[model samples]
Target chain A: MAASKCTSLSGALTRQLLDSVDSVLFDCDGVIWRGDQAIPRAPEVINSLKKNGKRVFFVTNNSTKTRQMYADKLGKLGFDATADEVFGTAYCSAMYLKNVCKLDGKVYLIGSNAMKQELEEVGIQPVGVGPDPISGVQIDWANVPLDKEVRAVLVGFDEHFSYMKLNRALQYLCNPDCQFVGTNTDTRLPLEGGKAVPGTGCLLRAVETAAQRQAQVVGKPSSFMFECVASQFDLDPQKCLMVGDRLDTDIMLGSNCGMKTLLTLTGVSTVAEAEANLKSECPHRQRMVPDYYVDSIADILPALQA
Target chain B: MAASKCTSLSGALTRQLLDSVDSVLFDCDGVIWRGDQAIPRAPEVINSLKKNGKRVFFVTNNSTKTRQMYADKLGKLGFDATADEVFGTAYCSAMYLKNVCKLDGKVYLIGSNAMKQELEEVGIQPVGVGPDPISGVQIDWANVPLDKEVRAVLVGFDEHFSYMKLNRALQYLCNPDCQFVGTNTDTRLPLEGGKAVPGTGCLLRAVETAAQRQAQVVGKPSSFMFECVASQFDLDPQKCLMVGDRLDTDIMLGSNCGMKTLLTLTGVSTVAEAEANLKSECPHRQRMVPDYYVDSIADILPALQA
Candidate 1:
């Protein structure tokens, strides 16, 4: 942990790191806030960064919310934000289908209405949201009427994921040409009281195992989410800094997309873990190390002060 | 592919192979019956073998049926099958927990009520059989009340498998001591019209990935099912001739349990698959090759009739 590896100090080096970045990307729920509560002075730090003419953007793997919902939450949390600046997996996934995959048919979406709304916003019709009930009898489960027009299967956070849906996804994906897309491969969702639940990764793996195929992930660490931000804002990677608390998702995404990374330790991962990773022999683990470390996003407020 | 490998012919070599075994194990679907119809003269062949003092038993990886249910199906299809003669994975899994794993606590079963019935028959109280509804809000998925009595998590053919159940299983399995067991890892269940649905293996792999641990599977190819049959019948594995349809599940189970295997083509796999495995360079695939090939279980009829 050298002083040079930290960009929080009010000095020439810290100012230089800040001066080189015109675009600022933030990961929600950890770096800016934890759960329902906003991190102390995090909103102020973000507002200050925006005031300095830095294009502040929110990059989240959370597929459960639409852009409008994320904008509403940001407004309520006292963070000066807009829907256009938010790059959620839900919106990015839809954007990915449109801009990158260039799919012509509807999406066999195994996600939520929020994701459906996002996909529909981009003119990509998403089918198979909500509950797909099972027919108690053993009538050829593989024979579920598949929509021939579905050219892709988009996986996200679905609360109603079931055997029927998983089977249908597998059946549809049997076509080698059918595209498979995932929101993110987050293994667990951390809850209050140190509890956790299965995330999109669990559902995605189930379908992958059954279908025997891989999904093109459109979330953090995949470069798709960052690409969404970069393509939309026309921001240069060298001039953009990604700030998040998680090393695997947010920080890895920054490094993966050739952008500077700032790790704030107000949420999941700790400094000790990052230091160990930096010294690890495994190249994959080493890549997850951030360019800089901070105790909290609030630490950056001092560097931005007059 | 050679005539010498054919066991259907009434020759000296065929008779010698049959004479070497005093016990006979038969797979249910595609071996004795196809869907709801009994294969012509298959039941007659089994009756003749039983009349000749050969120990007859039914072995299957289908976890959907209980022993009693299987016996009823067998009776309806013209086979004289007792509950003791049937060793479905549903029953064998419960037996594996009771005998092999020596589990003393209640089981968190992610399967049907038939599995629960089998567990109860073995005096092992099974919980978590039906739907586990989510709280809708994503506040605390990990905080779902876990039962201390739950000592093992058994995965089987569960139609009601949901995110909440999977999360709860992961939460409970987070305990290092909790045993993880799967009935079988059959990837797909073939239905009428050549349609297929995901089997227990898909569900099992999902849990295995989330828990980051392997489950001790108690179905075909694991030898646990044959061990159950042998322990119940007091028969030697060397003296048993296992008859099956699928090369992977049934024939492999036979090979793993040190029993001679006979493959019939009325089910999932074809003779070309068996022949390919027989000549496979990989020893793992070679082990799945059956000792003899028959066109159908009816191929054994003339041997039994004479």
Candidate 2:
């Protein structure tokens, strides 16, 4: 019935799936690379897909890197990619604030310098980027000098995230008119080994807890990410295939956008997890199940070569 | 007819309510004082309660100060109080880790020097109290040297709360055996002139988000704070009157512990809000509805005088 969902992408099925979609959107980190090292044959798969007259785009939730930085990293890893082909949260969030929110004033940014650069690229001013060391008493913090023009608070991956920054954001958010936006809700940034570090979600949660307000997230699973790419390239969702390692973010985003989804076993989620989602009664979990699963993005190499 | 819930405490009702409870637990900050100033005649009300042969105790969610500091503040405010008669999150959290969790190992404390002293007083060694400044890459952070003896992570109101602290907690909590504890979940610490600063809740939330585990909270509404006081003083919950300003923490704690709850108007929650909780069909909201409402804790003075 319907060729069975979450099937193994192999042989004729891989070729058939490739022919169905004109463009492939790949999630970074686990799908194409682990850390500094690229997954074996993942570069070949991406380059071959481009050579085969199919479009390829790299979409990542990591806000520490801008589009240009991502392109530079991709090139260093031997991947044939361009800055325009990358859609990171840093760039998309700025676009969202400018285009969707039509934010005219400055942003009280609790994020990296990359985010500041992205916001600047879009002609939006961002205040509070670096370490805002706590100096005064609680009353002093409550009365911390705030930028009068700051109309929004943007939370992302900030290495310098501190109590002062959190307090600043809360003070800005006390005015109900201030817009709150977050990059993504990924809890942990999985590294090369079993080791990991806290992600943007932690900082954002801290800010949310203080402000007593939920932030509008711009990363995966939200339609804005897919729409950001589609709007620029005029790409059709139905003719796009989303390949990712994570079921919750990448595959869920594909499902939300009505695009075909393929799960790669090289990342945070497993095939068993996808199957568990398939068998789950929850409609939300069901949306996370991919149409197909591959051992790695390298698995698509034979189909691309053919 | 039965007395209506959330009724205004005035005239004979005040005296009758006062005679009903043998002990009175007062919340600091909004209840007894606003910043450095006492709430009009709140100290007189507290001293009068003690003079009238009612045992009085001060319970606060603030983790910054030790019991001695609270007692000192109470004395300065003209309230008849002692260090033994005060229960704060700083002292309560230390008790929770030592007595409840039966923690025998060192703790990674994301709190203040007061918390450090409390932990030391309880014979539990705590490390990482001050600013753990960030240095090195993400991988370096993931592998940041962790104390092998640290078996618990305690979060409170840390002005030095940083990304490094959050990451360190995540690393410690990665060990499933490590205990996670928080002082309270009060989002804002209200200051004078309607200003506020981020509370312990924000810092604790970040750690929880990163750890992917809920902390054992030791403040208002958790029952631990009341139990800590009652166990030592041999006070009966039924004969205890929990008087406070906020409905969520103070009133909810009183209701949770089966004590009489009074909502005072001199603080965060309003009379209309308590009335709204009374009208709401939610069971949790119902718990938040205080049995009686008073214009101020000063209103009880006339009743005590009688």
Please tell me which predicted candidate would have the highest TM-score against the true structure: 2
| TM-score of chain B alone in model 2 | 0.98
Writing each residue's lDDT as its tens digit, candidate 1 over A1-306 gives 223443343356556778889989999987888888899998999899988888999999999999999999999999999999999999999999998899999999999999999999989998999888777666657677899999999999998888888999988998999999999998777765666677898899888878878999999899988888888789899999999889999889988988888888887888888888888899898768888878888877867875
Candidate lDDT values, in order: 0.86, 0.93
List model 2 lDDT by residue over B89-134, tens digit each: 9999999999999998999999999999999999999999888889
lDDT of 1 by residue, B162-234 (tens): 8887888899899999999999998887776666778888898878877878999988888778878887679
Off by over 4 Å in 1: A1-13, B1-11, B275-280
Residue range A177-265, candidate 2, lDDT tens digits = 99999999999999987999999999999899889999999999899999999999999999999999999999999999999999999
**A152 Cα displacement, candidate 2 (Å):** 1.3
> How does model 2 fare in lDDT?
0.93
Q: i-RMS, every candidate?
A: 1.5, 0.6
TM-score of 2: 0.98
Which 10-residue window of candidate 2 chain B scores lowest in summed lDDT?
B1-10
